[model samples]
Target: MKYTPVQYKVNATILIKSEKSGMLSELSAFEDLSIVKNNNKEVENEIEILKSRPLFKNVVKKLNLNYQYFAKTKFSKRLVELYDNTPIKIIFKEDSLIVDPFANFIISIHSKNDFTITEEGYDSIKNGVFGQVISTRIGSLIINPNPDYLDSFIENEIFLSIKPVMDIVEDYKSRVSIGLVHQDANVISLSLNTTVKAKAKDILNGLVEEYNIDAANDKNQIYENTASFIKERLSIINTELSDIEQGVEVFKTSHNLTNVTSETELFLERSSENKKGVLETNTQLGLVDFMNEYLKENKESLLPVNLGFSEESIIRIIAQYNETALRRDEVLKSTTLKNPIVIRLNEKLQSLKLSLKQSLDNQKKTLKIKLKDLQRQDSVMNAKIASLPKKERELRDIVRQQEIKETLYLYLLQKREETAISLAATVSSAKVIEKAYSSKNPIKPKKRIVLLAAFMAAFLIPIMILFFKDLLDVKIKDKKEIQKKLDIPIVAEIPNTNTKGNFIIAKDDRSIVAEAFRIFESNLKFLLSESNNQTKTILVTSSITGEGKSFISANLSIILADPDKKVALLGLDLRSPKILEYLNLESAKGITNYVSDKNLNLEDIIINLDNIPNLDIINSGIIPPNPIDILKSKRLQELFVKLKSQYDYIIIDTPPINLVADPLLLADYVDLCIYVVRLGYSDRELLSVPENLYKNKRFSNISILLNDVNINSKKYYGSPYGYGYSKPKSWWKF
Candidate 1:
């Protein structure tokens, strides 16, 4: 058999996981597996080929495996670790290498506090040490601990106890460590030996008077206390002086002294001269100096010289007075506005204002010229307007026309409002449902359709299945198909059995084959009785050879030959005659020989099977080369007529209609032609030939005998005994 590739659609319901619900949802769609050739071949073979291929089978297996995995592990732990920054690792059994550095780092820093150092104090110095070290060690392998890491280490043993000690050392080094120093050799000599002794004596007198201590009592204690206090005060003064000196050094460093101009050097010279005079005067000198310079010069002596103030007190008073005078002088100087840069700027600003006033006057003259020109244009426009008609009759006409248009527009607007109101109130003229819920029985799969489908499949699947089962089993399975194609009716159906007995009439009536003969007999009686003229010559034929047409004829003749009527079974298949062998009769003289010889009569070749009373058989004595031409001859018609008169019913088994034209030629001479159609053995497409014959009025009587129908096959229909057919164990096995 030849096969053609055909596209077949298959539908399946598959369960897919829902992304939102994380559960299975049913999905259904048709899929085109592939195009396949199906020329009477087994469907199981195609399924097996599809299942064996790696592409489809692997996909199916992977889907099933994934589903099973999901069932076992509902949550993907790997996915959680990926997004949540959780510390986790898949450790190889052999070696414990850290696979993920980022995860490990997160785990290490999870509990560490974010620390900040104070701007002033030991904390700052400690931070500075680490900062400097980190700056130096960057781009190198050394791990200078960051604030968080250091805090973590400090909280643990060994590092925690040493942290405070390290902080103190770092603070000390930062405060006192000076790496280098330079000295300047310049010096100023001062006549300060006698002055220092006088200042010390004066300070001692003030301490004795202030505390009311006797000058003679505990001199050492007073000296010691005075010296200690003075030394402490001097130390504080020295530190302050050192900070001032450092500021001067910073200024000198920022502005190089070597780069100073002559004018800057002169300014520094004047400042130094003023400082020298102040130092030479000894601002803390005695009251004698003050009185000599002030009261003594005026010759005004105090009332009691003994009550006069001490030299230090007088110097302190004079210093306070000088400080007040100096502060007053500074205030006077700022208010007097004698600064050279400010005076110069004021003078230049005054000169600029005078020049700007002169320039503004000149520009005013130019602006007046342009203003006069604009005034002239304004006058021209006024003169032109004055020259036009004062009443403007055309303007009045336009105004009158606009008023009329406005009135007409208002009228139209009112009409539109009326139309809109009418539309709103109008009834809606449309159909509305009166009875909404008219109930109806749901139409689903029809039982009649299912049963008919089962019957048709039962009739056809076996024949198709048998054709694919083996290549050489050529047999007819349906009688109606043969009748329709050959333009005839079914005479009988013969059951297949392994008995090798003489052709016997079914009188005992207990066998299945005998029951089938009865059915044929009943159909024949109905067919003949309904006709205007009884059909005596019935020709049984098939589409092709080996369709059991001869078997049907012989058995049908036996069933029809009752004690009341005569029946003759004629073997007219001249190409191959198996009737003589079937009946155990010798093919000595038969229809073929009688047709060839002009003097031969039907009586010379007729034989009777003893098992069937009133049943006679005419077997083909010899094979003929031109069976069609012999069947078309006038002698065959005369032979059929003679047998029609002698027999109540003559069943003639002819050759296959599709293989030869003998059946068609013989169909014209027979009273009724019975076509034998084998069910499983017949092709569905071949049924069209018989259908077309009937549609074209080839013969009047026609019926189908479905044969070889397998009632127990699921491919056909469910078994009558309800024994469920099991799926082929290796349905998809290749």
Candidate 2:
């Protein structure tokens, strides 16, 4: 959520700050070379170190961040971080608290030292005092009073909590954002969300301080390691120098050694050059030996490259090896050796190591040949200066080696001093341009934005529900809706009238119901196309019984029969008949009686009504046990053939097509099928049944009729077609 939840809100939550950090790219002669160059990567790396888990865990441990203390002030409901002003201290074992990371409870301070837990546990700790350890449902804990706030907050509540430390660490990690002050610049901008002003300052400042300490320590670590190596070597070399000096002293004392005589001075001078060469060769050889030993001992560590090796190429190769090793170490800090960057650095280091050892081998071999040549020259010079005693010559040899060891020892001493300088001058990665500060208001759950969002949701919810309700409604709503769903052409949309009687059509009637039937009569000419040589046998059926197919049929018969057109209203819906009920006739003799007996004819079942002169009603007669069997009889077809010659239009009302096959059996006799669908009553799903019948050509033609559309409803009827006449004065006048 853009507006995060407020439950995790703390005091002084929004912190915005910036600082300039001096990220050390490389330490050359203890110089901070990063200031002049664009070391953007080092700046990013320092920021990462600031947020590292190890560093964050140090902060957590220092501040005891896992246990949070909060209390309300006298003026506000907002809980502020008690921080150093906590009334009571909570003591718990980390191991026990880890079992339930969210052990949130309250301590009610009745007095300075006395308190009780508002939320008790199974242990249900009794009232305890300051410094008293009591067992609770969460774990064993103690409440210690603050000497400063003890008198200030009595009969007051302190809300204490132990949040899961690891999760909180991650939450802060995500919450604290780092940005560059400008592109390719060393300065960094840091922002963090926290509630307490002091806590915010501490977190931001603590992070920068720890980062500086860590960076400084890392820089010094290399120099310290180098210093340690030089010290160890100096000790061994010092001991060697002492032993050689002692041997020289003993040899000279035993020989009573003297200086050169006049004749042997030139010989001694010539020999001195060879002795100096031997000393220089020995020193280089000793350094090579140390290098070989170092390579053999350390499989994965930095080598001391600044050790004064006579071979310049050897020093350069070792520098490359050490640099690669340092890179590998940096990679290892964030990930394991399985990382590809670490693996590649490992491979490069191995190659450099091989090159370093080869260089040492070639230099050591050259030094040995030079030393052997120097010894041969010295032997020749000694023969020329034969007057000198042999004991004196032996004493000089001892003294020469002692000088070499002393020189090497002094050289390591100088290197150690340089390393100490580097350690002392290790620079901090960051310089605080400005200490961390906070915003005037909190960042999340902005009141104005949240109020706007809530207002929008409140207004939109009801409208969306109503829109979906209308979209997915299963019942047929109106004529246009049915037209959109089905392929059948709607012949007429009949409006339901206010009259209580079923029959509405009359001579010169101008009611909306009568007008709707007149429109249906006119549409029949287009529907009854194949009725040129025969009566138009129209079958009125519906998907279900309550769709007003029978009511529409009787009204259509009266409208069609205008003295020029003879219309027969046949009641063929033998099961659950409604035509006789609508017309108010007591004639029991109907189609069923005529169809079963040969003595009864079609004329016996059909009755003429005086109100509608040309219209005749053929009732359902007696309810039959076998309506389907009666409709299937040969007499039914013969009856239809006889009626086609006498009547110009035959309106036959059959049983609902969805309920029985009686309508389907008469499919051969009917010219057109009027499928009646009642608006708001008929199910939209039933339109598919009629569609399937039309597709299979079960009826020659099927026209749709929407019945019972409310005349006054603008949504469905959309303005009735005619102005209706007033109700009759007496009920039966019309």
Candidate 3:
């Protein structure tokens, strides 16, 4: 996976900590407004814009992501995408290209300017030069080589895949991740993962550029509006100032006034001080009236800010009102005046407008009071100068008017220049804290870690399967299965032996198998000690055929056949006899022959083995047609009665209980019943038959013998029953 493709994460982090910018426009706008701090919502909104579809749409269109190029070197199996650093550049003729049509082709480069275009689906190849425009089914394509990689891509195949722009945009959007760096910091981080590092960097940088462009435009709207207002005010003020100056010249020339008397000069100097106060008061009143009228006329439009208002509150309110109005205008552009955001902003504007008007009215009343006080003082000074010439007073009035208009004109003109400079220089809104930097290593499919994980999986998977196989196994693997499934006591465990013979016990043998049967004999002595009968009959049977009932019976009888003891190994399985085949003996007449012939006695069916002392084997001789009927005969019970009195111990082997009812039919005749279950052979579900037979008293004194036990297995020899114990593997162990 690591060798297949390498992807790098190109990240660009920016702080949305925009202040009332120091840009000429924003600075001019901020003069009347309080500094509004940037908030988390502003950062959140900026993040949304970073992920906006339209913002990314422009990036995709500018980068031409829809028209993709991939370079495949001769030695490489995967096609490496050619992003901004593409080896070969393809320029399509806009007019000749089909609109958003799907096309795929491979260009094999032999030289810097020579190439062959082969359509992926077509067998034909079209030859083209670097500068020539070649017309094809998809478009008129002009193929060229990048100067930096001109020689490097001589034998490379450049593959082209053109898709729809919408598809490319959606793909780009899905790969982009944008979020805040800190919840309260108003810092945003944007990142994208792609195979081509140059393309990823370009995309992030382009998105930031477009986002700032949008913000600059929003902030520029109010400044441009204010600048236009200042220009109009300056034009009117300039013309009025010019006329006032001309009136002063006309008044002086008509009066023929060249010089003034000392007395008149003294009175004029005193009156001028009063005139300055009146002028300032009137100027403020005029401003207030003009702004009030402007607000009434343009209720929904942005108010011209930075006007000289005496009241700081009025200036701040006007700035706020204009911003709300501007916000409304923007919202209305995409939707309607009825939109909730527009409606809310509109309502806020109305409220701010009312507040601004009241502030203007309050400022106007204060100015009027100041103007009245100044005018009254001027009237007293004029009365004192009543004896002076009326022409001189008229000349003084025109000069004062000229000064007032000129001062007002220059102030407006100064504001206009500042607003114009602000208009020209709209500072960026997005401040990049860190430029786009791609990581040095690929973000995914780390080669070393992946190979290590795969290597370990190869070893662990099989071990886990074997472990689970043992964990989930249902076979009666040990005496634990017998003890866990059945409540009955387990009498003995027969150790597995290499000897194939059914009877493995010998008087002189001291092997583990031989000692195992001796222990079995001791367990039976304690179990049958309470029986009043002189001899004990042991019946051995199983749930399934291959569960080693015959092996248990033959070995047990041979072990019990002591020098002073008489033991008879009876084979009651008339249908299929296995004792003669196991002992390698031939018998013409046995249990079946005696049971079939009413005149025959039990001695005729019993065969004595000369190789051993006091050990007699009864083999089922003539194969009976109906074994169940033959076992049900009155002669069968009488035969067991004679064997019980003659033999000290009789071990009877019968058919499997689950396969036939022959063993269950002899349940009443035995002193002790041994249910043989082969380890690793019998199913766990077969234990239910013995448990049920023991619970139902189907046999007297039922005991389980775990046969063919693997004594070398885990913790088997130390167990209570000395049966091979199989434990499920632990979950963590492979």
- Best model number under lDDT: 3
lDDT of candidates 1 onward, in order: 0.44, 0.76, 0.79
Over 562-622, each residue of candidate 1 has an lDDT whose tens digit, in order, gives 8988988888888888787766677678988989998888888889767776989888778
* Superposed model 1: Cα runs more than 4 Å off: 1-505, 532-535, 711-734
Candidate 2 lDDT score at position 226: 73
Better of 1 and 3 by TM-score: 3
User: Candidate 1 or 2, higher TM-score?
Assistant: 2
2 or 3: which has the higher lDDT?
A: 3
Residue 580, candidate 2: Cα error in Å is 7.4
Considering lDDT, which of the candidate structures 1 and 3 is the better prediction for this target?
3
Give one digit per residue, the lDDT tens place, for model 2 in 223-309.
766777888889899888888988877876787776746666667676677777887888889889988997898777678656777
- Give me the overall lDDT of model 2: 0.76
Question: How do all the candidates rank in terms of TM-score, highest first?
Answer: 3, 2, 1
Clashes of each: 14, 9, 2
- In model 3, residue pairs whose N, Cα or C atoms come closer than 3 Å (at least 3 residues apart or on different chains), thus clashing, are 24-422, 25-422
Q: Please write out the lDDT profile of model 3 over residues 1-734, one tens digit for every residue.
A: 83477888899998674454334235565555422222112666567667767778889888888878887645567677887667777789999988776879898898877889998888889998898999888789888778887787787788899887878888888889999888878678889988888888989999998888877776677777777777777788888888888887787788788777899888878787788888777778767876877777776667776667778898788777766665565455447777887778877887898888788888888888888899899889989888888987787778778877777777677667766666676677778889889999988768899889999999999999999998888788877666777899988888777565455566776667777888999999998998888889889888888888777888788889888999999888877788777677886588888887888877777788776879998887788898988788988888888888788998998888888888888877888999888888888877889989989998879899888888767748532343343344579975
Give the CA lDDT, 0 to 100, for residue 100 in model 3. 74
